[model samples]
Target: MNLPATYEYYAVIPHRTQPAVLLLHTENGWSLPCWQTTERHFWQTCDHINQTIQDLLALRVITLRCLFINQDTGSGHFIRVYEFENRDAQWRPPVNGSWIGFSEFKTLPLTHQMQRAVLEAWFTEQMEGIPTTRRAWARTGWFDETARWIVEILQGQAIEVSEAVQQVRTWERSCLLRVATTYGQVYCKAVPAMFAHELPLTQHLDVHWPSHAPSVLAVNRQQSLLLLRNFGGPKLGERGIFAWWEEAVHTFAMLQRETVTHADSLIAMGCPTRTLDDLIEDIRALLADTETLFVGGKGLTNSEIAALRPHLSHFLNLCQELKTYQIPYALEHGDFGPANVAWVEQRPLFFDWSDSSVAHPFFSLCLFPEEMEISFPDTSDWQMRQRSAYLRPWVCYESLERLTRAFEIAQRLAPLHHASRYHRFILPHMEAKWEMTLMIPAYLRCLL
Candidate 1:
């Protein structure tokens, strides 16, 4: 019987009377390895075949009696073909010879391996022969919703999603897929080798944030797929440095109180040791003068962002000058900034709890425009100028009156909050790298 030009078909020849299935490429008339040639026939037993048949049957396919046939290897192969038949003795035959012995080949399931292969193939095809807009996947609108998104990934249920035209990245190291599904949106960040270790950390943070952040919808532990709630907002980086600075201080204060309250609980649960002094030093170091530091390569001129180093130093110095050790308790947002906070309905929602740590409240206060300048030098000058205008006065205060007030209040706290889980967030480079260490001193000079 002749197969239709439009439809693809496969045929199976049994081996040593073993069951087999054959696949054919209709366009090229090329035959794919049938079941007889695959490891399935050699490693899988007849019982496995029966089980497969049963599973296929559950999928609405009918299995007929197994048969045996000869192969090119001079071996007998056993095979089975699912045919049109009813257990209750029902049969429907085609009226014409055009539709002879009837049956359709089953399509293979698209496993993760298959998806990766397809992606690679597509990428190769698109890039190999012709050159098009290399910027097809150029992305924008990278706003930080770390805190809110973390919550969403942990506790979010299935909800309708909005459509977005997002570019896809295919490199194995940074493979990512963002699609607008009927259920809000799906962003799959694939960290090839570390999915197992990273997935749980994300899930833990998601499930833990029941009240503060967005809910997590699902988690594919094996694939490191974090299905989270899409909290659309401006990242701290995009909010203009000045705006981020104001929000950082307030958020840090609130988070500090929460951190202290939860400190004892976290410590009891095996959390790491965190100290205020350690945090102060870390901020000081990050604000120190450094050369050729990269801030996601945003490319802003040195003058436009030169205030970063001095600004950070000034923040630390102010804390020191005010003698605000009253901030006895410490809890850090692990990684704090406007990127982690979302302005939802006029209220700021903190997110990205995965990096939560125990540090001084002022740790977040370092989120001033100057700090942003240092972190993201590639930012546009207009934005930097706008940020400088907003912060220039605030940084020039004669006294640390407002900052002192905050420290006085924070000192009343009894303990500090830090992660107690096996998962931790310390980057080795932060401690050993000299360039990163100087971020604080440079920023402190801004205030003077």
Candidate 2:
């Protein structure tokens, strides 16, 4: 049979295919691997695949190498081929599938092509590339519910979802979904019940600052759902800082300046306030915490945290000195990155506000040069450029010396959060955390 010109089809041939029928050995036969499909991206299709191979199949794979991947745009089907090789002698497949070889599998009622697709995807060593997913196979838990929720929201719409999937970064605590419909595509975001505030917060921004944010199409604050019309822009690249960063940061600075009057609206929505004033109390609380530091912090039972208790006053003094800079605080994006942005035409949109809080503007810089440089090695001094650009507007508001001091202080204090996390210069072993032993006085002596 000739495959359609619109779609391509390929086979996932095993390394050496004398294929096998992977019986689920269940009373009912819902465990067939044929359920696997393109919707799985990297075959993280169902939660059972991993456990079935490990616990049920009793096989430990040495590698899941990708043999090849061929696609047919005409049929909208991608044939991802692969093989799973066992290198250990102790590994043995379950007895239930003992007779699942290609010869035995053909005896089943399934057509030849259907049977082959199952064997190829199951035993493949590994897919060459796996798309990003949050909490591996989240569909196993809340996916069905999420689908129903979307369907219920769009029940009256004159469109059908051709495809839908959720992509989330391992570090993020939110779900970003992409849904392709007969008409076009739309995006959806799901946050925790506590973070449902994002629903109203985003909608408010969309109304008041639509140029910088995506408009909400539908929402269910109770479920923490926020649906947005896809802005139809390519996502910013993962590696390297680009001109978009400058534009976004500039827009952020502008937003923060204008939003100060609207702070009540945001604060009511649960954004945290951690300005320098707040830091004063936060520091004193930590000084108070020194009495119990070892009980809470990691690696502290080693006697190092105990030695730093006497220096609490010194740290407190530095915290007090930070007030002298008088740099104004503003809305801070706790975990900003390129992935959170999408451009609509020439306009750049900053999103993924899950970690946002109210803090010193420079506090946002914590993730810039340091964390961003890690992701984009070629990022160079993009942080410095952004820092200057972000601070440029506030130039007439404060002296350069004070702003510089505030920026430096934010560098040291930006990471201060939670009593349980390891704090630098508060312990003798702090050197191990940031290698600050030699430069300890350089960072902290000014406070003394």
Candidate 3:
């Protein structure tokens, strides 16, 4: 999809001393630089920084994604951030000319050599925690804070470490890095609220299915962080997709089964619980009070509310019909698919459990092939093969006869259960069309 032509890309390359905030010394004066488009020219900045690290320090670097800036004039721009590990030397401009810190870059101390101004410095507003957010971290900026947290957790466990770490890369609500210390290269992570169960859930597996999951070396659940074996290797893919899926799917089913045994513990610890049984009530309850559930009881007009009201009866009936199966409930990977599992050393370690919800184990598999195909459309016959592989576990538990019956019901009911989540009259997210997909069956069945 081509966005508006006015959109552009820029970078805020950061180092120990300060951030490189696009300073260009023109004949007019020294000013912040920006790009009109995110074409090859913009990528060159990221390319230069990455090359400098790979060649000079022999250290790897990963570039971060866009930090958007919405201007007062209603225009917007975005800049990606790149962080360097093992700061070998204080960074200097990739090109030669007068490049200085942001404070000094503003004074125009070398006004005589200045030539042009590229952008209206949106610096003040943009600097508000944009450098090192909870989602993304800067080593010199927030690594120490994270390091201190790690140290406290380790000291309590009586483990020692070296002063340096191999690298740190932050994403949405977690940080992944290789800590160079007394132990060999160990992988460390700080998960977000959504995936807090990763540590405890894995710890549970250690006792029940140690060979199937990652060993939690050390962890601080309060901080949503943990350390694990680096287990460095490419995740199963490229050519071994089917072989990997069979093992991965079986392992996933096993994990969900184990989760069912400890459902109370996991739920008490804040894992999302959305049971198929409860969904019937949730759909009706939300429909009854649609106005409040969406946006403070005001998001939808009365006409819209009336339109959705009658459909709830049929949706609730379908939910009741599906509940007859009583197909086992457990913690489900709400977004389960091939990409979510990583096969390491022949064992499948399921990652990205952020979408955990309490539902029928088979219900989770309803979209196994559908989800993966959406993510990777090119793969053809493999899609059905993967689905068959995923369904193997269910067959093992109830035989294909029962498994097929349960899954067919799930295909129809899962959509209604999912759509009911937005009964507060809130519109579904544009890209998340799955919500609408859920309601379509009920709408068609009831002619609403």
Candidate 4:
């Protein structure tokens, strides 16, 4: 499918003593280095920007932060401003672009009025030397404070910070940075208010299951930051070995079973409780919102939406039936797949608990079988084996036949789980809502 074009203007700035911005001279005038692409999401846009800058200017930079977003619905043109960092202190000017000082940049003729305004706002903020209230990591001072903390924490552990901290990823939800140390690498993760539970939840996991999760070195609850020892391994399924896949399912099932009694603790730690009854109410509300179900011409058609309305009764019946078996609720990793699992020392250690909740454990298996099939197509019985591995720990609660029936019911209703999650938790907190446009409707259509 062809996506709408999004024009991105990057303000490349060096994070050093002298403040400057990179600009390229065009026939019209000078402007921040810009590019146009069809990629809409922040991560994909960051990838495209990095590659384009490398190819065009032979320079490497890291995404500092998002400066602004202009989403003009009438014109159907979206503009995004991103700040990128050139970490080198002795960097030279590129062949076609020059690093203009902040004072001199004011006098240059910019190609667009919008660019000039954006640069002026940035310059004003830089000159005032005021810390940003939002996303403090975008500023250079954040790195310095973080580096000192890292040294303080590693002092008694016989480890030292060996190199500069490198940013791994940044977006609306979270930012990840990696620090190279004498022993190995450690990661620092920061999240916003919506995902504040991730810090405590990860610490809980490390305390309860030290062998299966990363070690937490330090935590700042006020800032929602976690310093963790790197759990080194390739992502699950990267090796193409079916044994790892089977083991991941089995181990995850064991973890879920063990945590069933800790549901209250998990909820106390801020994990949202999404019971079968709660899911039913969410589904009813979603079906009633006609506007969102059919928004943006890309969602379900009129006929499909009509067909979906009558099936609400069927969906509710499925949820009610699954609740009858009395399967105890546990921690449901909201976004479970091979990508979230890491293979460490021949075991599966799950990470990225930003989407976690306390709900029906079977709901977690909604997408695992489908993903396994895609990864190992040659293995005909992989899905069956995976189900058996996951359900084995739950056999103490119900017969294998009855558990299989419950699994089927959960699978049929899983789309509602995902749609409700996006509607309630994910989309509302995002700045670039268009990046996830129609996600709720797309998941709702899976019910058909």
Q: What TM-score would every model get versus the actual structure?
A: 0.37, 0.57, 0.62, 0.80
Which 10-residue window in model 3 sums to the lowest lDDT? 112-121
lDDT tens per residue, model 3, 1-448: 5454343333333443444343555665543333344343232134444444456435344444323332222433443323333343544554523335456556654332211132213244235534322243433434556667766655666667676453344444356756655655666776655567667765665656666666677777766667775554556444345556656776787677767778888777666677666787776666675434334332444566677677766766766666676456787765565555666777786655555666776656655555556645666776556556656655545667666666666766654554454332222322223223334333223323
Choose the strongest candidate by TM-score.
4
* 344-413 per-residue lDDT for model 4 (tens digits): 9888999888888999998887677878888888999997899899999999999999999998898888
Against the true structure, candidate 1 reaches a TM-score of: 0.37
Residue 67 Cα positional deviation in candidate 4, in Å, after optimal superposition: 6.3
Model 4 accuracy (lDDT, Cα) = 0.80
Q: Rank the candidates by TM-score, best first.
A: 4, 3, 2, 1
Model 2 lDDT at residue 195: 49
TM-score of 4: 0.80
Sequence-dependent TM-score of model 3: 0.62
User: Residue-wise lDDT of candidate 2 within 63-112, one digit each (tens)?
Assistant: 22233344455666665432333323454444543435545544554333
Per-residue lDDT for 328 in model 3?
Answer: 66
lDDT digits (tens) for residues 1-448 of candidate 1: 5422221111222111212222323343323222322333421123243334334333111122112222223333333221111222222222210111112222332222322233233234334632332211111112123223433543354443354323243221233445575655556554433223344444543455444455556655554455555666665566554544454455445545655666665544433444645435544444342332333332223553474444555445544544443444444554555666776544456665444444454444343434556755676573434333333333333235554454333322211112111112332312212313223223333333
Candidate 2 C-alpha RMSD relative to the actual structure: 14.3
Greater TM-score among 1 and 2 belongs to 2
Better TM-score candidate (1, 3):
3
